[model samples]
Structures are given as C-alpha cells and as structure tokens.
Target: MRSLRKFLYWLNIVGMIAYLIVCGYFQMTGKPLYPGQVGLMFQVASGLVLVSIPLIIEKWAHVALPDILVVLYELFILMAILLGTGMQAYSIPNWDKFEHLFSAGMLAGSGFMIYAARTPADKQDQIDPFLIALFGAAFGVLLGVCWEFYEFTGDSLFGMNMQRYMAAGKPLIGHPVLYDTMGDLLSDFIGSAGMSLYAFFKIRRDHSWLNTFKLHRIK
Candidate 1:
C-alpha cells in the first residue's frame, strides 16, 4: 500500500511537470492558451499537495486547514484566468457554450475540494460541509468577478470587444456583446452550488445517522 501510494504521488508530480512543459511550449509559440491551461497547473499544485500524503498518513503533515484554503484561493484565481482567456479566444464563433462548461467544471471542482478537505481523519462526513460548500460558492462568484475584470482588461489592452465581431479585424470598440460574461459568472455559481449539494447528499448516503449527528452536533 505504501509503495503504491508513493508511486501514485510521484506519478501525479510527473504528470504536472509534463503539463507545464506543454503549456510553456504553447506560450512560447504564441498559441492561444485555453481554458484548461491554468487548471492544468492547478492540478499540478494539487498533485504536489498529494506528494505529502505519505507524511499525512504518518501524521507528520504540516499543512493546516487555512493553508489549504489559501491554496484553494490560488487555484480559483488561476482557473478564472484560464476560463477568461478561453472566452476571449472563442467569443467569435459563438462557442461560449464550451466556456460555460469550463466555468462549471471550475466551480464544481472547487466545491468537491472544499468538502474533501474538510473531512475529518476518522469520520466519513466532513466537518461543516455546508459551510465549506458555501465557501466554494462564494469563491466561485469571486472568481467570476475577477474574470470580468480580466475581460475588461483584455478589451482595453487588445482592443477586443465582445459585443461585435471583435477578433482578427482592425480592433475597434462598440463590439456587439457577442458573449455574456455575466451569464458565465452566474453559471459558475450554479455549477459550484450544484456540486456542493450533490456532495452533501452523497455524504448523507454513505455514512450512518449517528455519524451525521456527530458531524452536526459534536464539539
């Protein structure tokens, strides 16, 4: 078991490094970065976190819940950048649906992470799972806000407008709002909240009534 866990841990690290290489190559070649780029890095960080799982198994892990929260915040920021860039790239082809799906995944992943992190060492039910879910939803909205700001910056810098046909032409203002940046933001929240609720029910199903009560009623 130990060897297998260690192998999985290192394998995750190698996968992350490989992803970084691909992303760097794309950036160097002036390829437009996509929605999953930052997510790939986020997975790398998550993998690095997993590398400590062996220590965590031995109860020598140094990371605290707040530290984990900070990392989660960073993950959300990177995901927002990725999602916004994808939106910018595909805003012309009416392919914002893919962008929405990406945003949804970001929100959902954050929600699951929050709940998983809160699970106690001994219990199947996570501590304050609802609160963790709330945290995830709030961060989703926070990421959405930052994404909108990024979109505005892109508009200002690259002269890319979402309103009208904005790409590959002489950059101009008064684009016809081809995409709903705000709508994407709301969709992010929806996805996050939905996943959180799903996890909540899953916990309720997998554990005993006594354990559930312990999570809710214990000190």
Candidate 2:
C-alpha cells in the first residue's frame, strides 16, 4: 500500500510536469491553444503543489496521514486537475457534478480523521454518534463552500469560467446562471451527508473502524 501511495504521488508529479512542458512548447511554437487552456496550465501547476502537500506535512510537521487517505487525495488531484482540466474531461456530461460528489465524500472522510485524531482512543466510543456525524457533515460542507469561493475568485480575477456563469463569451441569465452553482452545492451536501451517516453507523457498531483511518503523530 505504501508503495502504491508513493507511485501515485510520483505519477501526479510527472504528469503535471509533462503537461506544463507540452503547454510551453505549444506557446513557443505559436500554435493555437484551446480556449481555457491557459487557465488549465495554471491549474496543472497548482496541482503539482497540491499533490506534494502530504509529503511536506509528513516530513515537516512530524505527522503521519493514513496511507489510504493519502492515496485518495493524490488520485483526486490526478483525476480532477491532471485529466479533468488537461484533457478537457469537464466537457463530458455530468463529470463536474460527479467530481464534486466524490470530493465531498472524501473530505467528509477527512473530517472523521480529524475528529478521531483529536479524541483519545479510549474515549472514542463514549462520544455521541450524532456529534460525529454532524461534525463530518459540517466540515465537508464548509470546505465545499471554500472551493466555490475559489472558483468564483478564479472566474473574477482570471477571466476563467469556472463557475459556469458565462458561455460563448456571453453571460448567462436567470435560473440558468444559478443552475451550476446550486447543483454543485446540492451534490456536495448529499455526498457529505451520505458519508456522515456511514461514519455514524460504523462508529456506533465498531469504534475500531476508525483505527484504519486515524492519523498518527511521529516520534
């Protein structure tokens, strides 16, 4: 599992580097680039940094994130930034919504990890399952909102249509403009809620389930 995790990390690094090189080559050759290609280049570069964060935290903070979580995080970056943006997979119907749903669920799992890390192992079973579910759901929703804020900022500052507010160089109007954002939020909520319920039930049945997902402090 550790080897697989390391492979994914390197795969993202190499993939992003290759993408940047290709983009740079196209620009230097004066080749026509696709619309939003420039924005995707920025995303690819940012993804490189994003995928490296786990190692940075582990090395510098003396903390150890679970291998499964790290693998999931790296895979999300690979699919979302490397393939979704680079290959224009967002053009596929419903792909963006799927990504949002998956991301929220993963983030909810992260919330559980955070909660488990803070609670003493002996007292974990004593905590209310309702609180656990609420915390995970809230945390996932909060991060989902933060991501929307990021998309809005990117659209405003970079002229990117990340929020889907514009089409064909024209701004959308009425309910259509609200559709994408609202849909994304709804998907996020559903995904998080589902994961929270899973956590609530699993923890109630077996507190040992968290042991598989818990983070560790390095000595």
Candidate 3:
C-alpha cells in the first residue's frame, strides 16, 4: 500500500509537470488560456489538496478513510483534469456525462466512508439498509449540486463557460443551460444511487463488508 501510494504521488507530479509544459507552450504561441490550460492548473492544485485529505481527517477528526478510496479519488480527479477536461474530451459524445457519473460514484463512496467512520460496529446492525442507501445517495447528490454551483460561479466570474451558459457572446438562459445542468445532475444521481444500493446490500448481507471498506468503526 505504501508503495502504491508513493507511485500515485509521483504519477501526479509527473502529470502536473507535463500539464504545465503544455499550457506554457500554448500560452507562448498566443493561444488563449482557457479550457485545458486553466483547468489543468486548477486540477493540479485540487489534486494536491485532495491527496492530503485522508491524513488531515485522520489527525483532526480521528477518521481513517479507506486507502482504496484515497487512491480512487485521486485517480479520478487526475483523469478528469488530465484526460477529460484537460484534453478537451468533451468533443467526444457523452464523455462529460461519463465523468459526472464517475464523480458521483466517488462521492457516494466518500459518504459510505463517513457513515462507517461514525457508526459503532456493534450498533451498525441496527441501522436500516434503506437508510444507508438514502444517506449515501443524498450526500452524493448534495456534492453534485455543490459542484454545479462552483461551475456556475466560474461562468459568472470568468468567461470560461464552464457550465455551457453561453454561446456566441449571449447567455443561454433557456433550454441549453437547463438541459446541460439537469442532465449532469441526473447522471450524478444515477451513479450515486447504484453505489449506495450495492453498499446497502453488502452491509445487509454481512457486517464483514465493513472490513472491505477500510474504515474504523467508532467506539
């Protein structure tokens, strides 16, 4: 696990270095510093911050997030920045939607970790499966909404058009923005729902599932 963690750390470092080089080349060539250039920088910073989350939570809140989850989360963020948005993969049909789905699943997993971290092992059985699913899905949806809000803010603050809120210098106040935003939300919900349902059944069938998730049950 330590070796794998170190590998991921270095992988991110290399990816970030490559990203800066590419963006710098574009900037020097008089290309606009939008989309991939801006997004790559943001993703690199965000990935660094996310890499510290597990350790920070462990120290401050006494929470131990699963190592698998930490790796998965970092990989997804890197993928989005490095391949999806950073590579202009939105030109491919439904690629953005796939990313939204993936992100929501990651959020659902985080929710499961949080719930597991807070619940006592002995009392875990008393919690309903439906409640587990509901909590995880709800948490994922909340995060999805918050992400949309961030996109919205980005659109307002900069002309990045992160939310598909404009075309040809005119704001899209109608079906375009509505369709794009709602579609993302729906994808997020569906992805999260699937993860929550699986977690619910796993816990229902055996308490041993907790061991697989790598969270320490609170006393």
Candidate 4:
C-alpha cells in the first residue's frame, strides 16, 4: 500500500508538471489560450495545486487529484472550443450553466479540504468541524479572489497579453474592475457559506441522533 501510494503521488506530480509544460507551450506558441476559453494555463495550474496539497499532506492513495485535473482540463478545453474564442459571453454556444455549477463544486471541495486540515482525528471534541470547514471555504474563496485580482492586474497595468487572449471574443478589452471581481467573489462566498452551514448542521444533527440512539444497560 505504501509503495502504491508513493507511486501514485509521484505520478500526480509528473502529471501536473506535464500539464504546465503544455500550457507553457501554448503560451509560447501564441496559440489561442484555449481558443474558445476564458482562463489560461495558470487557472488550470491553480486547481492542480489545490488537488496536489491533499495528496502530499495526507498521502492520499486515490486518484482524486489526477481525476480532478482531468475533469477540469476537459471542461476548460470543451468550454473553450465549443463556447467561443475567448471569455466573452456571446461566443459561448449555449447558456453555460455548467460554468457556475463547476465553480460551486470547486469551492465546496476547497472548503472540505480546509475543514480536514483544521479538524483533529484523535478526538471528536478537539474542534468544531463545521467551523473548520467554513474557514477553509472562506480561505479558498479568498485565494480565488486574489487570483482574479492577479489576472486583472496582468491585463490592466502589465503587458501580460494573457488578458487580451482571455477576453478573445469579448466586445471590449477592460471590464469594470471592481464590479466584476466583486461579483465573482460574492459567488464564491455564497458557495462556501452554503457548504459550511450544511456541514455544520449535518454534523450537529448526526451527533444528536447518535447520542439519542446510544445503548445503555442497567445491571
């Protein structure tokens, strides 16, 4: 089991590296960064990093990280190709409802990971799992906001060029910096908050049920 886990861990590392290399190639070649997509290689790389953390910290043996990477990759690629030439809305072939769904899932996963990190395994009373999860989700969302800010900066003041590429089919170059970024941030907050409340309430209810169902024999 140890050997297999080690192998899988290394495999994930290699796969993430390879993914970055491909993205770098795309950047260097000046090919449409996803031709019909919004984010660049960096967005995918960020998600890969999130998936990698649990594997490295917990030594997880499962294929979760790689699987997630694959899913995100395929989704982004498909979104890019079928949607349009850039992050613009008109280019999308459909309503793109999946985009919001995927974002929520990402936030939820991030929240769960955070809770895992904060909660202790040895004792049930060590910390409130719900609180941990909530904070984790918040942190994850904050990180996302920071990333979006970085993108904004790259496209605005700097010559990142990625912004233009990312905005491919959009009618305009610059978006309302504060408005759009805040709106996205709000969405992330909602996702995290919802997951936190759900987890907290669920844990409380389960504990109540378990306590009520405990068996006691009088001798």
Judging by TM-score against the true structure, name the best candidate.
2
* TM-score to true structure, per model: 0.42, 0.82, 0.74, 0.46
Model 3, stretches more than 4 Å misplaced? 1-10, 19-63, 157-160, 214-219
Tens digits of per-residue lDDT for model 3, 1-219: 556755775677677667777787787797945654665667655666665566677677775667656666666655666666566666787777887777888788788777877887788788887898899899999999999999989877876787777778788775676877898899899989988888888888986685556565334
TM-score of 1: 0.42
Q: Residue 151 of model 3: what lDDT?
A: 90
lDDT of 2 at 211: 74
Ranking of predictions according to lDDT? 2, 3, 1, 4
Candidate 1 weakest lDDT stretch, 10 residues: 210-219
Q: For candidate 2, lDDT tens digit of each residue in 107-142?
A: 888988888888898898888888988999999999
Each model's lDDT comes to 0.50, 0.86, 0.75, 0.48
Ranking, TM-score, top scorer first:
2, 3, 4, 1
Name the lDDT of candidate 1: 0.50
lDDT of 1 by residue, 1-219 (tens): 334434544554564566567776786677835655565555555555654543463354433322222333333333333322322334455355345544554555454454454656465444555664566567666776676787778777887664333546654345334346656666666756764565556554564322321212112
Candidate maximizing lDDT: 2
Q: After aligning candidate 2 to the native by TM-score, how far in Å is the CA of 172 from where it should be?
A: 2.0
